[model samples]
Target: MNIKPLFDRVVVESVQSEEKTKSGFILPSSAQEKPQTARVVAVGPGGVVDGKDVTMEVKIGDVVLYAKYSGSEFKVDGKEFTILRQSDILAIVE
Candidate 1:
């Protein structure tokens, strides 16, 4: 299945979170935090949003950092995805 975001929304997939500490201690799933980094799978077309001229800065395949609890989550074809506004993205990983 393919995803296409509308307006300034973007679809991203989470990267795997670290399950172990740097000290070689393994962390349990209950101790894991929500992953804030994700890979852009699809992006919306840049255009007028909420009466403002919005432009998209990130494109598909870009790795980005977002707020810890931002965006909505969903699943497609057994894979998880998140849909968030462009502004929710904090930085693009170079």
Candidate 2:
């Protein structure tokens, strides 16, 4: 499905958490931790600030780091998605 964000909001697809440990020990899905990383899917044009428009620092396809509990979850085309404000994104990864 086609999705678009508005006014500094961003849509993201969560990166799945690893199913195994660094040592190659497999972990059950119930024991796995939620992922804090995500890929930007859609981004809003900008946010209003002091009557002026403040452009977002992130763009579509940017990988970003966010707080574990920062966004709201939803599903699109049977795939899970997250909606969050720009402030919730911690950093953009290279």
Candidate 3:
């Protein structure tokens, strides 16, 4: 299945979080923090939104940081994804 976002919305897949600490101590699944970073799966076309000219700055395959509690989560073909507005994305990782 494929996802195509609309109106400046973005679809992203969460990147796997590190399971080990800097000291090489392995952390349990329950102890691992939820990854704040995600890989862009789809991007909405830039258009007028909320009466403003919104431009999309992120593209597919880009890694980005986003607000922790934003967006709606769902699953497609057994994989999880999050859909959010472009404004919720903080920064694109180089």
Query: Please, what is the whole-model Cα lDDT of each candidate in the order they appear?
Result: 0.96, 0.89, 0.94
Report the lDDT tens digits of candidate 1 across residue range 19-70.
9999999999899999999999999997999999999999999999999889
Quote each prediction's TM-score: 0.96, 0.89, 0.93
- Model 1 clashing residue pairs (backbone): none
Scored by lDDT, the top model is 1
Which sections of candidate 2 miss by over 4 Å? 49-52
Residue runs of model 3 more than 4 Å from their true location after superposition: none
Candidate 3 lDDT over residue span 1-94, tens digit each? 7788889999999999888899999999899777789999999997999999999999999999999999999999999999999999999999
Q: Report the Cα lDDT for residue 22, model 2.
A: 98
| 1 against 3, candidate with superior TM-score | 1
Better of 2 and 3 by lDDT: 3
Q: Encode model 2's per-residue lDDT on 33-84: one tens digit a residue.
A: 8788999999988869568777899988999999889889999889999999
Which residue pairs in candidate 2 collide?
Answer: none
